[model samples]
Target: MSQHGVGLRAVMRSAAFLTAGALAVPALAGCGSPDPAGKPLAGPDTAPAARDRIADGGTLRWAVDAVPETLNAFQADADAGTTRVAQAVLPSLYRMGERGRPEINPDYLESAKIVDTEPQQVVLYKLNQQAVWSDGREIGAADFAAQWRALSGRDSAYWTARNAGYERIERIERGASDLEVKVTFKRSYADWKSLFSPLYPKEVMGSPDAFNEGARRALKLTAGPFVLKKVDRADDEVRLARNPRWWGRPAKLSGIVLREVPREKRAAALTAGRVDVAEIDAATAGRLAPHEGTVEVRKSLEPAFTQLALNGAGGPLADERVRRAVARALDRRELARVVLEPLGLPAKPVGSHVALSGQAAYADGSGALGGQDTKEARALLADAGWEPGTVTEKEKKEKKDKDKGEKAAGPKKDDDGSEEADDGTYIVGEDDKARGDDEELAQDGKQHLKQGGAPGAYAPKGTAAPARSAPGPLAKDGKALSLRFVLPSGPGSKTLATVAERIRRMLDRVGIRTEVSKVEEEGYFKDHIASGEYDLALYSWPTSAFPATDARPIYAKPVPAADGSLNVEQNYTRVGTDQVDQLFEQAVGTLDEGESRALLRKADARIWAAAGSLPLYQRPQLVAARSGLANVGAFGFGTPVYEDMGFLKKEPGSPSGKASTSASASRS
Candidate 1:
């Protein structure tokens, strides 16, 4: 959940609800609109039924945008698909409950609790003794120790882009027996539960080479209810067969085929009975209402949100003013309306980067800088010496010279579509709906501009500001105000493409020109988004239940490691401040929920000031599944319990799955 869209298939944080070779949609709804009076936070819409009432030995033809690039979630190339694959095959010690809290997964964990805080933090894990990997290796201390070594960041050889809680690990050892593990921490880690959720085997993590590249190729060993059977790349599918050695409840379905079906083809696949379960966009769901008997579309907001990520590593955006200028240029509220209004949900922009609107910790951090104001954007650009109506002959010639023989960036790969990949919100074609810039520029209110330094080596400190009267491309030192906007192209990326196009027009009005680059989905996150090869990108990241744990990596300052490699972890934007890092450190170390929320709020404000990324709105979870499917569909805050998913038993003499009929649940 790169592009967490720096995407979530999130588990992609580590595996997941994500489908990532192409990028993924992670299923994380950090905070939600549920009332405090006991309503389910995720408001899960999957049809619930007792396991005994569910049919067994059925196959779930799942539609995923892409298969995982790597089986290991820790690998640099791993995406949300990596996480989603692990969801069924790997062992996660803890899973997210509907309240957006961690709940122990009894399949692998018996109990996990903090036993000490004095001197050093320590945690004791009680694993289920019955749990064993496919090859008869017990799921115990070896696995935990190996994983800690691989992910703890002590060894630079291991390619772990995200080492959140693992970085704080001091040591991991066997507790009383192989079934129990004792973990000691170098620092206080309030979100320790976040670690080792989708635990890999000792065989996979025992060595750096195996840890780094082995998982990307094959995870021959697994312990979950389902095990790896085949990765049918020719068919764009990852197939899983039920594990015969599973000790917990037998998986209700015999196998799950995660097929790569394009978003546009989703409805047809559903109607044709090709896919039993799939995630769809609001438009797709809207079209399915007339034929609700074929599939029931469920909707909910996920823990993740989509955003406009600014690359502050270099170019014009290195200046916070330009970043904020771009932020103010877009109409977030209207964008939210274009995406979410289709679902009959509230169409307000998500206010905080740290939390969703309905959650208790949620607070609007966007206003600390200012609201949507094209006028302010123009002023900020002008103050930075990129005055409107001032494009010099040199700039004009350069712009013309750069526009020859343009070609698509690369052959397009199938784009992964998850709420995470949707950048979490549609932010789609408000085409004719794009706000008229001429009208917006005429507004009287002028936001206070926090003027920032010019881009490094762009111009001297006191360059004369040109007259800012008319509208035209801004220029500074003979260079026009422009940015490289990288976007993904493929079936699942229509929303992302539309949003990018719309954003292009919005920036155009404020004298900022965006050079659009369309790249293959396979390299979108790895080669572009994560590599910081573009000035601006729009994507989604699944917000975490543990904000301090997850958000820290995404926003932490890039530091130099012993190997001299920039240890960015997950801070793909290449922009961070010590203040932001310190706030997260304080928040993660602070165990009290209220205090942590306060610290995170401070961090969110700093992030807004940094203007590395702008949270747009909650990405709605739109899942369409054949009727009678249970325990899987639009899981909001709730992590799927893979074993419980299946077709409901034909009620006595009910019709088969193809003709199965049911109405959609009440909108959560």
Candidate 2:
């Protein structure tokens, strides 16, 4: 909450980390570093050289992907946008430090420590004497108690997204004075720093009604270095000004403005002098890095990774052998090649769910999936009672009949004797020849592999395969091995579509049929994926500083609702194994860092054996900033302190100078 860094994409990026609880450990070497496949991890330099002087005052205009649906970061609908906004206006007790560990922020709290762990885990926090809300209310133990009750999962009406570590809290009480707060846990929690992170005021967390309604509008009272000045939904921009009542060090900038910009237009926006900073991908970075203009590209390896989540509760994925077979058939290396290599990036596939490639505790366990072996895949399918020969004959006959039906319903001729499109979707009479080098789309229109456009632009331009060879259609008891795959179809969906198409091809090679479903981007996570509506899905999870505790909700068993329906919060895969849950608790309860790391590694091995998901690769966190911008860059593991961010002041009408805000509008 002490505005560590003000990033428009923080909300979306932080959304991936909301699934689980948090744990703790001493500071260690950072997790991310430059890899051989790419350039040194680039981003804004948080720690600058001594000779560089910090600027006093200026306005910084930045770009964000979308407008936030709500201002509350605790709500179920909160996303990256929410976190970005919250960072400026909320009170974060701790921030991720340079050592990739949680560092207490002195701006909000004077000190915090583990006072006792004998009878119950007790943590004491001393609030700064000057720390008070915009409403002039002192931050106290009541606010802490209110937040714990709202997020503890004790009241179903709260509608919280996660309650993993919070439910273990026993009580919250005031110490000697209103400035002191003591929190007692029912159990010894290692990741206690994750709690009350962006501590909310009692006005917001006091009741279910307040939690629901207060979040719908802009925050009224804030305690951070910056305060929300304006939220222009009409123009897709949020404006913040330095908080006059803030007791901490005065913010260097007079104001900060965040504009909502599309992914494709960010580079252009930075080039056109419309914004000061923009986050670009590797392809965009390559294009802009050579330019010696005012713009500079900063890149860092993100702690997040992408994956194909296979549903374990129902459908073909319900069987563990089928899931393992699917994992074996698809070459993850080939996947990395198709997705990352095109952009001249690394083609290494991530192997663990809990740890990323560059983390200190990282280890690859994907070998348990047996590498890419179509032979092994077929054998697994055969062992699961699915016969390849019989299913192949029936599938071939069905395709033959379907092709005849499609030819019979061919396009109609116009009055000019030109053939018209059959269904008025695609134009006919054009060349239908196959592009041998290009990837083909699936027969069901659900998947595409070619690099046509971003995610949803996968249109098949090549001919279908002449023969169903490798592994014939897998069938058992008159049922074919068919799975449904759902992906987003909005702002950032182009890559997802491409990945989904490639996966569809891999599954097809092992005689598994996949039906691809496209959902709107806004509802992709909340409506489709989180609801468990697909047999398979594509998504990413952000790793937390305390990964062992934070991953509990993601791999934990689904808690049941009062009506008996599955109430899955972050465990979208629906992996309900008691062993995974036990391992998570053991890791979280372990105080020794080495023991915790070992336990987490064991848990990850179990996850791979389950075969519900295959980690693809670590995503690169890239941000483009104009030269002279200091204290604002890509933070690999920690939040950027907003108060510390400023640009080197330039004379009027200079080439690389900061400017004031003008027109504000949303771009698709």
Candidate 3:
């Protein structure tokens, strides 16, 4: 097992990736970049600060894409917003450190260490006597046991988001005292510390009904610095107030307002003092240049990569050759270079879907397939029965005639020979709202233009009627083939829009057409991408430290359940194989680092071959913050110390009042 426990939040992030659109994998070790841990202030630029130096009671208006659909992070429909709120209000026994290692939260546990390896793996945990839930219940072994039983994957009735580490746990017992927890595992799990994170109370975990929807909209029990004050979806915010019953170091701020600001408005909100911190897009970062000293654009290498996902459950993408054709048409390398090179980071196509460039297990699995090749792409499409011409010779000629009058209707090429859309900022998220959890998924993944015209398509925003070209997408058996390219129209999506536009042009050259659907950022991941409502979509996946457990579900093959529906798990692409599953299982069971890496590499290769998604590049993690603020920014792998977050008080004679950046606590 990996030294760092790739436990709950680790698996939660992957499962959440299905809902939230983040897919950070397991095991991260790197250099020069902030993606890897252990470097000085490089990983997550939260601007560390001592508890005493921060000004004690300022409300921090934080920005998020949307308020979590569920307060329960373990629910299948929970998103990154759930994780955000959970980090501040719930109990994570071990939080991720700057270097991707899991460290104990002494506020909850006095110590947690492995006690045995033979017979059966066992871990001993000593709980903090003062650790108690918001309802005054002691945080005890009952909570752990209840959580294990609910998420152990043994019961199909629970509807857990994932059951990674729990499935291997044989049992959880109390030892010596009620505060002492003895976790016995059925196997050697390297990422043991990953479990018990964002730990829930027994009241919620003990019952299947409660675990399903009880905490979906509200949390009755919380054990962290902040408590749920309100979930105002109407206002697009999840408000958190300071927890008076908290036993740890007092939170420096009075409360946190997790406000949902569209990516486009986040910059204005920050400038107007409506938000103190926000994850800004590249263009937003650039736009904030004039406010440099006052508003700093903090950059961190996130454990995430943006990719193009192809729905393989039905339609043209269901064929492997067609999927490969789509992959070969796009110039991922050029896209990465054009977007990230200007940001001062070394830009290149993120080689592996399973791991980012900085991780020790990172490998270029897409290499054997070769780079973007138009000739090869056309060949693949033709071979797959997608004829090079349109549905009829007349349609092809009409398209050619229409092309003569227009400028070929493609992305405007910039002066540097690079493609540019109306804007340029990148955000990794879904593009529509969600429906019922158990509703039938969009297996064919199709969406049509239902309104007057595309709301936020290629044309500039506010265009009453944008031209939506409907030229014949190459057809087979007289059926026109086209993919619904879903994109987000929100605060920080200039980059996403640009990428989508370029993809459309590339595919157009090969006689493939796409219908663009610009959707709201709020439910994009939950409703559209994960639900397979779009035949083709672009989104990002955050990395995790435990690959076997965290990354497995993302690529695991969908299997038929007794309910007559395919239990796709987190493989929302609805495509995977037994070979990948076997590799992930072997990696999860192995304690040897070298062996695990080899298995993951093989799995990644198979994933690339499957062509479910094309890894594009490392998503840019740009956090815009007020200079005086501390303990918040592009967190990368580390979770924020919410209680330690606050603004700095000015020094006695310092005119600039900027010593605050340096006031952060020393790196561990």
Q: Write the per-residue lDDT of candidate 1 for residues 327-412, one digit (tens) a residue.
A: 87888876775566656555677767776654444666665556777777787777666875575788678667665433334223
Alpha carbon deviation, residue 424, candidate 3 (Å): 8.4
Candidate 3 per-residue lDDT, tens place, 382-464, comes to 77787744456886687678667545664445343533212232223221242110001111112113223335655666667
Residue-level error in angstroms, candidate 2, position 23: 26
lDDT of 1 at 163: 75
Q: Judge candidate 1 against the unseen true structure and give its global Cα lDDT, from 0 to 1.
A: 0.70
Q: Quick one: best TM-score, which candidate?
A: 2
Error of 3 at 20 (Å): 31
- The C-alpha lDDT values of all candidates are 0.70, 0.67, 0.71
The candidate, 2 or 3, that scores higher on TM-score is 2
What tens digits encode model 2's per-residue C-alpha lDDT throughout 138-174? 9899999999999999898887766656888999999
TM-score computed on alpha carbons, candidate 2:
0.75
